[model samples]
Target chain A: MTTAQPLIQARGLVKRFSGFTAVNAIDVAVRAGEAFGFLGPNGAGKSSTMRMIGCVSPPSGGELRILGMDPVRDGPAIRARLGVCPQLDTLDPELTVRENLITYARYFGIPRRVARLRAAELLDFVQLSERADSKVEPLSGGMKRRLTIARALVNEPEIVLLDEPTTGLDPQARHLVWERLFQLKQQGVTLVLTTHYMDEAEQLCDRLVVMDGGRIVAEGSPRVLIEQHSTREVVELRFAGESQEPFVSKLEQLGERVEVLPDRILLYVPDGDAAVVEVTALGLHPLNVLVRRSGLEDVFLHLTGRTLID
Target chain B: MTQLAARRARPGPARVPALAVLQYHLVGYRRTWRGGALSSFLLPTLTVLGFGVGVGAYIDQGVDGVSYLEWIVGGLLASTALQVAIAESTWPVYSSLQWTKIYFAQHAAPLRVADIVAGQLAFVLLRVLTSAAVFLLVTGVLGALRSPWAVLALPVAALLGLAVAAPTFAYAATASSDSWLALLFRFAVIPMTLFAGVFFPVESLPVGLRWLAYATPLWHAVDLSRAATLGTAPVWSVTGHLLYLAAWAAGGWLLAHRALRRRLVV
Candidate 1:
């Protein structure tokens, strides 16, 4: 097969559940060996779109092609080549950690001997070799998540789909998972992940689409998106005795645009220090001040008027 | 793309492996031994001991020329086999469809839904045959088999059980929930057991009730088993009884295959 064709392509995709539209018309194309991400808030149709690409749920309308084949007509055949890690771990609780990988490999028609060898290698890769024989019910949450990722790789799939890979984890566990994902990326495996964390998107994805209300409001690399939707630096200000209403009028001349949040007001400017000096010259007594570089969180909040963390 | 299409098109007759279905039934049997085996053996033993000795002193051996103990033994063997087949076919089949998801696991492979239903029926057939063997041996100790033909009745009784169980499995697979199946057992199984001549002769019923016995699958099973044991069936030949059971088995199997394919594959 030629490398010119993309591994996944969707044109004007639409998905509906009952009478409610979950995912409206959207376009997406993912090429081979590229790390892509779907960045959105909760209930933003990220998982629904991932399910369509995974060939588990049929689309309501529009065209979807996976591995250059139709997703609906060739679901089983397409699923054989793609791996899926759902938001919730669906690992067989009755089986041991090693058996989980072996059984999943068998479902993809892998031979028994190869399945056993692959299970052993994946257990070591996920750093669970010593706990291979233990049942899944006794494992910690992080261990179960790692095992789910291991099961997804058992068939040696060309593309792996992960839905909210690190939604619920401590900092240490999240870093451990990110390190393993980086290793997979270095091996030239294509990855598609959905995450609400702006840092996760900035750290992992080469390019992404910011979705809100079932539509892609913006699409670009993290750096490109920040440059397009926001200034390079942002200055935050909190008033001590005065309301932000007077400061919003006084700080109008300092930056390109001003965003008034409930607690503090943000000044979008090319240089945060220059904006802070101009704000102090206006005879404003602020309780707290912070200057930092802009990120995807700023871009997300600017386009959708909704904070990603909330 | 064209090359991959050609690779998928090169196919002969698709066959599901037999061992996968064998593993499925073994897993099920390991989970529910009392429902499948223990009750099948114990229920008939209790009936034999309870009725054969407790009530045998009051009822006299009639002009048919067989003792009361011998007369009731064939009916008990047939009832035991039927009960085992019914239990395996109904709730277990419903659970596999809705709760356990074992069929989904099997169907994700090369195995089709039809292969699953066939494998389940085959497993139930084996269980019924084993239960029939044990019951027949107990009846033999009780001296219920007066002729050499009673030995051949083992396979006959098993085929009779399959006749009833296969159709019941077809009905069970179409059930939507557990409550629906509870209704089926309450309304269908209990009534069939009482009126199907399992405990007494169908002639003892009134004329209207006698016609109801003619439509039941178990009545034919009991009649054939009793005829084999005591040589008392005066109307239907052995060939006739065998043909009737064969019709229900074949028809029910086809219906089950179609129903399961429609519900699962899409």
Candidate 2:
């Protein structure tokens, strides 16, 4: 092992359930203090890959390591140092919010006195100190997610795995979860998360792998991936008198690439204003025009041939 | 050798888990006290009053020559023990697996599947033992105890409860849906209660149905308790009955562990 070896490493990791393959020979490596993300659509094997890294599910065949130890052989020891927030909320409803933290700490063999102090601190860190005595069932979605995060941190884990940390929450709830995750990232905790939301991946992940059909299609920093796959600017034009098809051929020569949507046409050009002026000179009467910088969503669409939301 | 030494340095399996499971039982017992206490006390109480007092007023004590109240008290204790075991083992176990997700929460920690099963069985056995103790005390207050041999009935009832609870827990863990549990209560528990000689002697039933009584754990428990309480020996050896219950408990525990390990670990 090298001195700069990654905290987590998997080589040709394959996980299959019966005849169905969930993760098909994927290789991944995550270093310390780096926020990594797995961006994919549903059933794209993101959660399965996270579970294997969390040491909860054994890989069907792979060379997997966590904290420089084998996951299959040293799961308990590796789990002791790693925190996992699963895709679903598995908080104990029977326990109070504080008790949930303490009970989880106990699972890692943390002493009761230390666990209590840690629970109090973590509750405060999650901004849930006011509701520490409340049962988990009555808490809102955001509070439950925060408590799950707090529970994962009880052992002072070196690496925290969050699977779709803000999938179903409202905007406010998602922002709160994102802010807390940002703080963890600032504290130098190695965060590995999976999210289908491109904005979430861009905001939270320093490096990410876009997965589809049980394989990694692209991997890099969000900005690097976007720059590599998509142009800097895109111009959108909608026609009034004719369908978008007629304008696609007319606009194709003005930009490096032209993509036709059902209602609008996109011209991916180095300069948005020049593309818009060139489009207006074509004598095509358009209903609307828009120019914006390219984003991770555009990169995802370009690679996957489908929008993230669709 | 180093690994063995490290293993030995850790606490015994029985110590920390016993405390955790004990705490879990206390919480569960508090939650279900209203329903659990009523069912445990009411069924035996009603049977003693309805059959032992009401029906006993009409007929003389038969071949065994024990008072009707005294005779039925042993059966009541035995059946109550079985009921407590069945209640703890079936729906609660199923709910823990499916709805409550309590077992998953527990297993996420240092607690192994064996710890969970052991804790659950231990809690159920404790509940049955406590209920049996209370029932036996009430039976004594009602002057149902004919001899000191009645004292042996408490442990016997607990063992009988384990005999039923252990295997039932194994079955409950393997069930993927709640409908199977409904069937168990409907076809198994209800029929066993009615025909297991709880309210009356099984010998009075037709020979064809008598075999069904013999098949039930409660019947063997009741026969053993009745023999102990009335000082009349049973047809089967007490060792045989104890061994039969032990076999069921052991087999059930093994099966439950296997099923739970397969489900949770994979």
Candidate 3:
């Protein structure tokens, strides 16, 4: 949490593919022993940024420093301290689970004995020790992701980069992964992850940036971002057999903002209970109503005018 | 935690990272090497028995002062190594890049694109040399090694293997579909093996076709191998063959590095 020195720093970083610009000039910095996240939907250049930080892709322009070293000249040296879990599972399918970690550790020149011990410990950390001898191909999606996470920890890296660590997992699977990552964070391993799941960001990221169209639109803690961009509460109203768009004019001034979605109209207000009372006073008899605290999803929708997952 | 402290207190010394990349493939190969054992030993033995002894019995006057069994034995040895090298370079390299994504995993680690390409070439060399070793053993069992100098063919086969594999590795990395690899085998690898003096002397072909075989890497390999096994190599010009093969290996490595960098490094 010390700002005197950051573990990763980028200034005006850019990435372009052929004629298409994937990441525009943007700046970011992350401190040691903290969890930072890039929150964006697909095609927002989240994975591209992760690749640059991982030292697998050279930045097309601008300056990026990881561990206070240039990426191009010192990629190998930098990567030695990085553990990257790519969006897709790139585990060696032919090798068994334990072999995958042992082999990966060998790439870092870790001695065989140490690699074996670390692989065992990491397997236990990820709770995959019982399946250590199983082939990676037949494992469930959750198991594969856990294995990938465990593989990333083989080097005991200073910073672990996870690109959409829980993209395709079931709810239960994601929670298990989140728990393991939380443990890593508790152990003082800095984690940088990209996820479109707002709940995930809220649960795991101590601080994050919301990216849209390859640009960072906002940066803050999940709670701070939500409070900055949205109200303290949200009131959802759904009128049966109504277009819902017509109610926008009626509900516009009821709160700070009104958002009309396909099935519901959301009112951003300081107090959801007061907003509901005000709505009834206006004689808007709604078929359904729900009041909930605002979250990162509201912040994202407010900034981008699009859902994060969409 | 202790290991983490150890790595932090003293990072490992810098070494050629390609060897680590090579170790990855070799470790995977350990599980699959048994599957290849049957083919590596069986195919060459069959080729020697089917053509060297079965067909050579018909040619009363051996093709070159030696028995046809001995003449074809050396050529088959070189072609076998070339085939093994090209085979290793094609689908396995392609799958590692595309399907299996082993190179992506490696690239995400500390290794560079050049290290990945070099490691793949090294693995191909291991395969070619392994097959060559077994080929040499079979030759010895069949009494094909006429001179003690025949041991030199093993290293010669290694050079030939690199010459063929390096460029194929570049092609595999850049290819969009696996279909093109099938064409490489059918048009390039098969023709070089069958027509590059492995089955018969290139001098017997039509003049236009003779030059084509002379230009092939397999032909140079066969010439060197035949000379080593027969002890009839021209002493003054052997360096020329070695240099030519070296040129192929060096050039192919450069192209593979470029292609792999483009694909993996973005």
Candidate 4:
């Protein structure tokens, strides 16, 4: 089998729920051995697209293939070669932490003896071996999340799908999960993940697509998309108790573009430090001023004009 | 088959999708089987003792030409099977669908919806058959079972379990709350078990209600079990009762498949 074929290919993929369309016609192909991401806000159809690729939900209208097989006809066969970590933790509370892994493995028809050995190794990999016998109900959220990730790998799937892997994790836990995912990428595991956190996307994804309102707004490597959509640097000026709308025109000359927010004005500039000096020379005094490099958050905002949460 | 089962790794068709998922339930059951032990065995023992001895002494001649103990043993076993099956299906199915989302996890694996449903119902049948077997043993020691054919109740109980539980699984898959399950037990389970010739003959009920008992899956099981234990002829032929139970199980399975697909597959 040649590796040139895309592991997953979709053309004009669409998903509609009753009268409302959740995912519009969009084309995407995930290559083998690459870390791909779906970056979007809450209702941007990222999860819907992920579901279709995962072979759990059928596309309403499109040509889709996974492992070169029709998902609807060969779902079980395709799923046997996939590892999926859903958005929510679906760990079995009644079973112990280790039993959760072993039991889930049995679903893939992994023999009991082999399942036990793999479960042991996976528990250790997730750093939950010490809590092997502990019931799942008592574990912390991070522990449960790690166990869920470990559970997905029991079959040694060709492609792993993770849906918002660290949405509600603490910063430390988030870093731990990201580190584990990066190691998987290093090991040549094909990964397709969805996240609203730009840092998560930047840390894990080799290339990603930004989705907004059921459509792909931009697609490229994180660096490429950032360069394409947002300025290299940004200047923020916060004024006290004002809409910052009145100062929009006053700072227009300091940067290529000026965007106003509820409490601050942003000057999209090539160089933030240079823009700050020009702002001061222009006689624009604000309560607080800060300068920073533009990132994926800026790219998302520039393309959609709405914050990730909203 | 025995060698294949003994071996730890038997791939291919040996790993039937239903069997794979059933194996999961068995593993989980090992940790919590104690929680159900008391009710599974003790309740059957006590019910047989109390009703067979305590209530039977008051009546000089038992109904249907047999002692009350022999007469009720079949009904008791059938109803226990019904209760075991329904009890297993309700809360567990609801929790897996809505709370733990176990079905979604399983559906993500290589198992199909039919396999998951069949595997769960198989677990229910296991509980039903084992509990009914224990009751049969207790009644046999007590000399309440008169014929060797009484062992046939074991299979009858299993059939009853699937017939009722498959439909209950469909209901539980989409039920929003345990209160709905509670309402099912209160309005359906209690009334059906009570009136389906478990406590008394359905012939004594009014004309309209007699048909209700005949229509219930539990009554079919009770009739078959009661016939075997009393060494008497059943209300219908042996094939007739089995066919009816088979129909319920098949129909329930179709509904369950539809509900599971709707709920699990987005």
Give the per-residue lDDT of model 3 (tens digit) for A146-258.
Answer: 99999888877889999999999999999999999999999988999999999999999999999988899999999899989999999999997859988889899899998
| Residues A1-310 of candidate 1: C-alpha lDDT, one tens digit per residue | 6788989999999999887877899999998998999999998999889988876568998899998988777766676677777787776555678877875665565655666778999999999999998888788888888998898787677888888988898888888888888899899999999999999999899899999878888998899999999999999989865457778987888898888888889989999998888888888878999999999989988988844434
| Poorest lDDT segment (10 consecutive residues) of candidate 4 chain A | A301-310
Ranking by TM-score: 3, 4, 2, 1
Clashing pairs in 4: none
Error of 2 at A281 (Å): 2.4
Best by DockQ: 3
The per-model lDDT (C-alpha) reads 0.77, 0.81, 0.89, 0.88
Which DockQ values do the candidates obtain, in the order shown?
Answer: 0.14, 0.27, 0.59, 0.50
Question: Each prediction's TM-score against the native?
Answer: 0.74, 0.89, 0.96, 0.96
Per-residue lDDT over B1-266 for candidate 4, one digit per residue giving the tens place of the 0 to 100 score:
64344333422222688987787789889987887876777877788889988898876799878888878989998999999899999998898898999999998888889999989998988988888888888788889998999988898988999999999999998788779999989988999989999989999999999999999989999999999898888887889889999999999999999999998778
**Predicted complex 4: DockQ:** 0.50
lDDT of 4 at A193: 98
What DockQ does candidate 3 have relative to the true complex?
0.59
lDDT tens per residue, model 2, A21-102? 9999999999989999999899899998987887767899978998898877776667767788877788767668987787
True contacts kept of 1: 0.02
**Candidate number achieving the greatest lDDT relative to the actual structure:** 3
Q: Which stretches of candidate 3 lie over 4 Å from their true place?
A: A1-3, A306-310, B1-14, B234-236
